[model samples]
Target chain A: MHSLTRSFLAVALLASVSAAHAHRTWLLPSAAQVDGKDPWVTVDAAVSEDLFELGANALKLDGLSITDPDGGSVQPNQTSTGKYRSSLDLKLAKSGTYRISLVSETAMASYKLNGEMKRWRGNVADLKKEVPAEAEELSVSTTLGRLETFVTAGKPNGTALKPVGSGLELIPLDHPSEFLAGQPARFRLLLDGKPLPGLTVAVVPGGVKYRGVLKETALTTDAKGEFTVNWPTPQMYWINAGYPARVNVPEGQPRPPMPAKRYNYSGTFEVLPQ
Target chain B: MQKRKLLLTAVLASALPALAAELSVKIDIPQLAVAEYHRPYIAMWLEKADGGQVTQLAVWYDQKKKDNGGTKWLKDMRQWWRKGGRDLEVPLDAVTSATRAPGLHALNFAAGKAPLGQLAAGEYTLFVEASREAGGREVVRVPLSWPPKEARSTGSKGQEELGNVTVQLKP
Candidate 1:
């Protein structure tokens, strides 16, 4: 009996350790319910487990699945978080209000019907509600702010242009109309190819305008030398250009011109219907 | 006398779409709904009925947008992204537009030098593809008749806000 008892205790101990290693957690997500407007469900969840051995924020949808009441699974896309993306082909699979079973490495968390799963606009609204109104003022516009965020070691710091790595390189999404009237596209800036750390580094004009109205934005870049913005509306747009600078290393075959005329890169294009 | 002869030649060339060549087509764009007041990127072109490309008509583009001329956004058109948007460093400026409220839009086109009549009579198609920033897309095709029927306008529906899109030629 003593031997049996000891063996049972050992098994329990092993199980507990295995559970602890998952290190999964529910990143804060805001619950929402709106009228005809599509109420979005934004969860800052993270799956930091070795099962998939995904990268730090490998949030793309490989394991995560959502089944609606109609017996169909949901497909997610327009991934603000690139770590894990699912259902990116655009249209949702029409799950019709079902439970979102979030199965992490160790945590088996789930969200009840929560609210109406109308059209999910996981953007603007989600980032606006809980996020500071000031921050919203910054994130809501389609112009680049002066904020630059740096993410290294453990602390994610925000600063101006003083970046840690080489510099910020902006890469835009591949769309048919690179230039459009009112749509918001993406321009990604990287530090040595890898993400700048924080989220995105956007490029925009001095300000933005809407509904025959114009307003200048204030929010600047964080430290990682990154920001996000939508494409300007249909109008003549001219804004100062500035990007995160890189560390001036001395050991390279060649170097760029002094101070780098890249300070305010400028070019122009047109947008008209054919 | 020489100028008069040139004028006559130009008139004859422009009047030929009725004799041999015909123009017909449809344009479609895939749709993805997102949240933003911006319009989708669009691409329009011509394709031979037998699956050969004829020429690129236009690309809905934005000039004031960031990296607007990057040439990368061309891929959003898919078909254009694959066939040409990916490579062509087009000489002309981009053609884009602001987002439209829920509704329909009809358009028209004029004749090209030597016009449709100049081409050898055969089957052809008109293709238009559109991709919005935070909306759905559509690719519409309209079969061109040997001679246009007074530039009739018609369109198909899209999942997102995009409804019917009709393009005809004015007599």
Candidate 2:
């Protein structure tokens, strides 16, 4: 009985680890700020367990979008996907801020059919037609996630920072490219164009391998959906926040109904030394 | 009494020009003994005491590069770039010049001039930042009280990228 209990605990631990600490997706720019008459920035897209160290899997670029300083859609000059990361070059003709993002939306469901558990994933519009009508113990959920970063060719501007009014968004009170070490930077969180309060934001600085410590800082938004981060040093940082924290149920107990939808937002920012 | 008051106003107005101060800045670019050396890019500007406003004084870079390639490295002067340099169009005829050799350089500006003409009478700070291609970066600051109460000098020193930097105010 003791050995069985030990094995059960091990299984529980594994489940929690996989659910809570899944791989993180990010987009890293070659330079957050550039100069000169004609400037171009290269971006790397990847998913890895470690922060900013691209070795796990290349993040697909199908949903890639680039917003120029004028709030107009722009295309990447060149793109390539390798085993570990995807890279793209974007020419910045205008002299202001640009937004690069990977946006995706999908539907996921699980149900018991013929006493066997089945799962399906597809676009939201195909959910009804794909899933069987008589499936038992059916549960469905939708996910919308955005991973983004900002680059400024010359003077930074706010034209490309307007929220899309659908999923989670980060609005910077202080210009992202102007962040300095030991200084506090403010940002507001929104959901569906409205303020999202009391959400926890995880800020992890890059160079985890050299530091040997995660040094992740957790900040909670106030009533106004605003949070501030005091950067520790000059380096690239990843900021992430998600809604609907995972719930753990006891064994032999029926799992509670999961939330119908989930939203996630993450951005990479570079901080300079004072 | 009205005639006397009019005469007093004219006297004060005429004295204003005489009170105008002249600012002289001397910057020293150090010569480094390294395997590879490139002349450092420099940016000079004056900021209000509270750091509210900035007036660019001069920028020394490789103006002769083909297709204006020299401006590409101007961002290496990170502090100046973030403060106000990034927005400026390089090769500005008024304040832009070619890179200088390793020596003491003097720049003089009159109080009633184009760049300093609009400056208000108050405390101000001068910033001189330098960044080299294959070397280090440094910044030197000097403080001044505009329309000087008396002639005075203030300066700062940089260890590696620069040498003695002095600012003189003459009434």
Candidate 3:
């Protein structure tokens, strides 16, 4: 293999190792909070390690949907996709919290001979599933990714923000609109309405432009399915949390412990400076 | 393993009410020594092991108070407020009631019913958060399993405002 290609594979392996199971699909707004007078927020959606830096690559926005504070739909004006990033612009008309949600279609592929999964950008087919006879024996499956974020104009009016998605969900008990810097914020995580304990919820300050290794402060929820994160500083914070689904083998199938399906849930809420 | 699996399938397919599960919660309100003591606002809800909120069972406050002033202190039950309290309007029927006097108060709901019945089968935590006016705040959590594969119950004790909280899931 060429030196460049070999180094690229090394980086991918290193990134995957460091992230563990971090197929985090997050929706990041240019600004989580904006002035009501001229409220316009740019949103970036991606399946990546640090929200939307394109460290892995850009994810397609086929199932992208944005709802304004008044429950009206906000359309993306300009959408441009690059090797690493996909950007869109949203016009914020009303003065409330706008919810952005993107549901990626399921992308599946066979595992490498060494049992490691291959990385691919955008949506693609599982060649192994298509031609089973010609494909490898063992395979990997990733469930659809669900990403969501919230932005606000004026003070967070507490409108249009509800946990209705079917993925691993984080429901902010405190209003995300009223987050203050340095104050602790509490959130509850649930999968199918059940409190998920021991979830590693990470909070990253700023959007993709964060410098110095993308420092993220993470905390694990207690037995009560709750976590309190004290934002180190007041800035636009992207809080990402998720878990993998259990793998159930069929009744008569040889149980070699199949790989579990993974799901990613993410959101962005700003903690304004006091 | 096979027998247990078959039994689980049979129970899931059974139409008999004997398979129905019932959730009962007992919350103790401690009588504290303080001047002008008022009953604390209490909120109870079910959450999955992953922290997903199921359905809220009840919120006890002075709903009958004039000007809806009792709700102003509801935020003091900080855990419940972020879980689902802030999303709801005050005086939610069947879910909101006046605070109970200091004692062990019991609330029951049958499975396949509105609140508890709406719950998807899973292991859950019953969170009971209490915040009193001119008093301390406390929260207690008890683990519970629904669609009672087997009859089970769990309980926990609170520090100050709240006392013992017991959750029983009966088949």
If scored against the real structure, what TM-score would every candidate get? Answer: 0.34, 0.56, 0.47
Candidate 1, residues A110-226, lDDT tens digits: the string is 111232111111223343453433321121111111111111111112121121233333333322123465665344445445554443221223112111112222223345434
Q: Which scores greater on lDDT, model 2 or model 3?
A: 2
| Best-to-worst TM-score order | 2, 3, 1
DockQ of each: 0.01, 0.01, 0.01
Interface RMSD of each: 14.9, 18.1, 20.6
Model 2, B40-103: lDDT tens digits are: 8899998898755898999999887779988988987888999889999888866899988888
The Cα error of candidate 3 at residue A232, in Å, is: 1.4
Worst 10 residues of 1 chain A by lDDT: A142-151
Classified by CAPRI criteria, candidate 3 counts as incorrect
For model 3, the stretches where C-alpha displacement exceeds 4 angstroms are A1-25, A46-56, A70-74, A111-138, A206-215, A245-258, B1-171
RMSD, every candidate, angstroms: 23.1, 23.6, 23.3
lDDT of 2 by residue, A198-220 (tens): 88788878886555334667788
Cα shift from native, residue B164, model 3 (Å): 48
List the per-model TM-score of the A chain: 0.24, 0.87, 0.70
Winner of 1 and 2 under lDDT:
2
lDDT of 3 by residue, A1-274 (tens): 4444444454444334223443455666777778856788887766654444566677677778887877777787778777776778877777788888887645444333343435532243544344345333334445555677777888776556666646677788787777897788889887766888976766766543333123456678789789998877776666666465222233334333323355666677777788
Candidate 3 lDDT tens digits, B1-171? 999999998887675656466888889898654322457889999889875955889999977556997787788678899997888887877689988888999999887675666677778888988876534567788877767775677899986677799877777
